[model samples]
Target chain A: MGAKRIGKQTWKPEHPPVIISAAAVVGPFEGQGPFKDYFDHIYTDIMAGERSFEAAEKEMLLNACFTCLNKANRTPQDMDFFLAGDILNQTISSSFSALELRIPFFGIYGACSTSAEGLALAAMLVDGGFASFVLAGTSSHNASAERQYRYPTEYGFSRKPHVQWTVTGAGAALVARDGEGPRITFLTVGKVQDFGIKDPLNLGAAMAPAAVDTMVRHFADTGNGPEYYDLIVTGDLGKFGHSLAVKMAVSNGGFDLSKNYQDCGLMLYDTRKQDVHAGGSGCAASATVTYGYLYRKLMDGELKRVLLVATGALHSPVTCFQGNNIPGIAHAVSLEMI
Target chain B: MARDPKRKPLTVDQKRYTEMVRDLVPRPPYLRNSLLAFLFGGLVAIIGQFFTDIYRITMNMSVKEAGNPAVATMIFIGALLTGLGVFDKIARYAGAGLVVPVTGFANSVVSSALEFKREGLVFGIGSKMFILAGSVITFGVVTAFFVGLIYALFVF
Candidate 1:
């Protein structure tokens, strides 16, 4: 077993890393959304009895990571590496949680694509015999995200029809080389794709092309089309971006993603009822859905193999305000039941 | 001057793909949005005008002085509406139309404060009470002061 480089941007690991345990913690809003039962803990309030939404986000991730470890009957000392990320300013939420956990930490930032990136990186590390037990996770809080990206939720500004509400949740999973669970087999790192979209509101449009790019590349590299996977899940393209990505895949990627394609953003919330304008985005959007609902379905024998392509809009509020076009990235991780 | 991170331009095919993507995705209903904005905005304005008229008729002040009180009164009404959780409902439909008025300013200030009421008073309310409108109010005051200073100089 050596370096698992298959083609350009694709990693076919010699030994797939097993997802031993997964945990998700969400706020009241997320708890009320579609997949409430899948989440381990959903606080009745965003604060989670903390002072600020930032503090709440940190708490949520810490709790989720703790749950992940506890489920695997492992302690903090058992973890070889803790990989985490968030959409916070400087990724403060994950940073603070890492500091508390005291594991060999790798702080990641892939915008909303963070969860899949963490899983991909953790799996690679585990497969390469670098680390045995890796905890990979990410967190996001709607209030904290709003305070940072848009106006604070309290501002009562008119909600933009195209803007996505950042999910108020955290998700964590334990990945190991030797375990009896679902395994990660392939990872296709995305290229930076900028379609020259400048509007912060049009995030779905901004990230759709990147998702389409990585997805098509994954199919080409693996020599398997969309029909191979039980589900093709994108991280957080939301409603419009998900639709646009499907359109691109059909025409450009030479495959129809209509049958198996389901976006994490769309799955977590009933769009018609929830006022989550565009849909849910942020690290937690994909994180929770993957670690909770998707993993549970895999365990329940509903899905055998799934291709999770997490998309990210890599634009800071500064870049958006500065009138620069948004750059997008997507990472593909193929998962299978062992 | 060069851009710090100068990204390469998309290829001709990628550009075409992007156009196709933009077209495939639905544009938000601009016509409905404008209609809602107009209807909700007009209603808010009518309510504000009613308050202004009341102040004009009742108060023993000039039209200009009455305007100050009227605006203040409207802000008070806005804060009250926000506290009752009614202002947000109006804003959802009214968009920027309602936000351009005195009520919108009040909504911005009060909403932040109220949202953070759980975070305790000093840092939450005292410090963050004006997260949204603080800059706008500051700019308005500063600009007015400078303009007023110049106008006073000219008049005197």
Candidate 2:
């Protein structure tokens, strides 16, 4: 059907939504990363003068949202809607920050995949003639997530090699009805997939199937293979998940991403020196990497097309504690330069 | 080891795949960890007692009351040490010992907050400050309540 809806959940908008401006805010650990130059802001103090980690996360989201708006010389009033989320209990970090922004807010909870999900939704909104401009953002703080998912920092329990460090950063993008920036062309929403994983430590393995499933769906829906995009990036599969996704795609989905594929988790830190175990993860895993580093490359004419697949493990402490399997989801958004 | 009959068994391919992955990964050192834990745990406890002595002698507080300020001081020192990046090194060396005290908790909070500080204050520090420890507090409180219930029912 030429009606924009493709074979499955992929939405190929007649008018692709344009990302006019974007910003990525990272923390000290990320600031020391190889992609340090990609960040817009980095703080030395983890506290950044906030009383608590939750407040710090809220601040990061607000700052990124404002930074994105300011880049376009637009105010909160200029924006039609604010779509944001984080890896926090009830996603209070996003909703509380939304209250301050005063824009028509839509709080999402796709766990760490919130960045891509927000982008996809914002693109659909802009393309569907719903809003002229919208802000899509997501964040994660190391401390906030560690406590919610695992033991308190004080417990000092040794971490497993498979465990990925939660990224402590925020990324925001300003999507416009029409602009002179990279345009969001296609959107692929993921289905929840679970391969019967129980241990929360092996998230990469848990999330790999979801990423592969979404990747397959995106290719099927768009009728385009891996050759279509200049780069294919996953939010935070780390190393193991990235390889597993490739293996799954090649064997089951009949697609190969060997040439142009990267994982934000692996890119965000120096695993050798950083001691991040499997690498970095969380909302910022995709947000900062795509918006700050990759988007910069796109604008600099280093790349033409990019397909960002943000992955999330939909597992809560309650679920894991209750001995339930971890479900995973991934969303993809294709960006093309105008 | 007794196998669970109720649990679904892994397929042959899945079993092989697990073995392949496990083969590549090295086993973690447990002996070294125990030694460090013993040493570091004792050292940290000694430091806590020192602070307790200071609070008791200088602040003129009783032994029971001195612990509050001592624990608070230890937390502050732990956070400070973590901020300077000293705690991490100690943690790496001391292993489990570094993880058992108020200082370890401080390190967790400080390190987690610091990890994302650049993301901004509200979310980076405020939000992540408790990620590692929030569960501990919640569970600790919950367990205490249940234990208190038992005590009230039987003893108190």
Candidate 3:
């Protein structure tokens, strides 16, 4: 199918305007600097002591939320709504982070795609005249995640090379009333795909098909080919999944991925150095690219049009044992600075 | 209460036999532990490709000749290591150690299922089922943008 533009969802600064003033946040777990140096230690502290998930999330989010608000020269109360989520069971990180803001809150669950999803939803609400301004953010913690999801600290199991490093930090973006920056032009909610590969340890290979599906759809929906955007980014498919995604795009979907880059786990981390197995986590993949790469490039005026395709793997052990396949989903949010 | 022996007092040997329970646990030979990892690590690295190949073919399929010597060689190596149980041993030693690259991944799914049998369907099987694969999605997005971002900065 040719790329088809959905409803008129374009937002220019001059039009019934909600401007995106500043996009900033505290982390992304990138540097071996202060945040990384103390990540494991703080994570250990939270995991070892008697603390609720809420408290831990609260501690992490405050640092990031404050950083974002400080950067925007705005306070939490200035935002009409605070949108956020994490890999936690109930999005405790965002919920607790919201406690201090006292702004109307909306908690989201898009896994790693939460960044784009949050931004897209916030944009839509602004464009639709539901609200004037909104702030969106997402964060993830490695220590809290490892214990909650997999084996505990006691059982020392060596990680595989293709594993993703769960990000230890957080990031936030501010969407304001007729501000300056790249505007959200087009967004296509992805169609979920499943390959029936039921191994949690090896994720990249499993998510390739979904990434392919979404990329294909985004192009088809927009009627814009690969040439439209300067870059096409897919959220964490890891190294293995990234390769598979490329192979599928070229060989199966008939699109060349040689030019496209992925934000998978393996691509983000040096497994040998960090024992992350793959690269980084869902939040890390998006957070790093959004802050570390995308925003930076946008600031530099390197390119005007870009497409962010954030992919996610929706699976739980119970579903796998129930003999279910891994369901993959991707959301494409197009960014263009005018 | 005095022990009431059926018929007669139990003899020491009989009592010992009755009280003695055979330990079914496999004892580790210190010698086998060290050398096993190196051997198994190589085997795992080679066989790990089987999972990769299958996944590649299934998702990113290439319609090359199905039955070629190269393919045979790959399968032969996979079977040889799998039969030696070297891959399984590596899995036992290295959590992602074996699973990280490829062959170990299959073992991870199977082993994790074996470990948390009680979480039964959801927690044990379902949760562990596609748990870490999010990394793939995470990286897929990152690299796509990273490449694009880099292209914007340098190449573009």
Task: Say which candidate scores most in lDDT.
Answer: 1
Q: Write the per-residue lDDT of candidate 3 for residues B82-143, one digit (tens) a residue.
A: 44545454455644434444444343444444434446688866776544444555687899
lDDT of 1: 0.87
Interface RMSD of 1: 4.2
For DockQ, candidate 1 versus 3, the one ahead is: 1
Computed on C-alpha atoms, the DockQ of candidate 2 is: 0.15
Q: Provide the lDDT at A158 for model 2.
A: 65
Candidate 2 C-alpha lDDT tens digits along B37-128: 89989988999899999999998999999999989998998888877767766776687787777787778777777766656899867887
Q: Weakest 10 consecutive residues, lDDT, candidate 3 chain A?
A: A33-42
lDDT of 3: 0.60
Docking class of 2: incorrect
Provide per-model DockQ scores.
0.40, 0.15, 0.04
Q: Count the backbone clashes (under 3 Å) in each candidate.
A: 0, 38, 79
Residue A27 in candidate 3, Cα distance off native in Å: 7.0
Which tens-of-lDDT digit does each residue in A1-338 have in candidate 3? 22233533322222323324433232333444222432212233432232543355456566666666776688877888899888778888888778878889999987777877787777777776777778878877665566555653223344455556666656677776577677777777766665645556555555667777777776665677777888777777766676666766775557776775656354445555655545676564675456445765676789777787777777765565565556777777777776
Question: Cα miss at A182, model 1 (Å)?
Answer: 0.5
**Model 1 — TM-score against the truth?**
0.90
* Fraction of true A-B contacts recovered by candidate 2: 0.15
lDDT of 1 by residue, B33-111 (tens): 7887788778777877776778888876666767777788888988998998888777887776778777888999998
Better of 1 and 3 by TM-score: 1
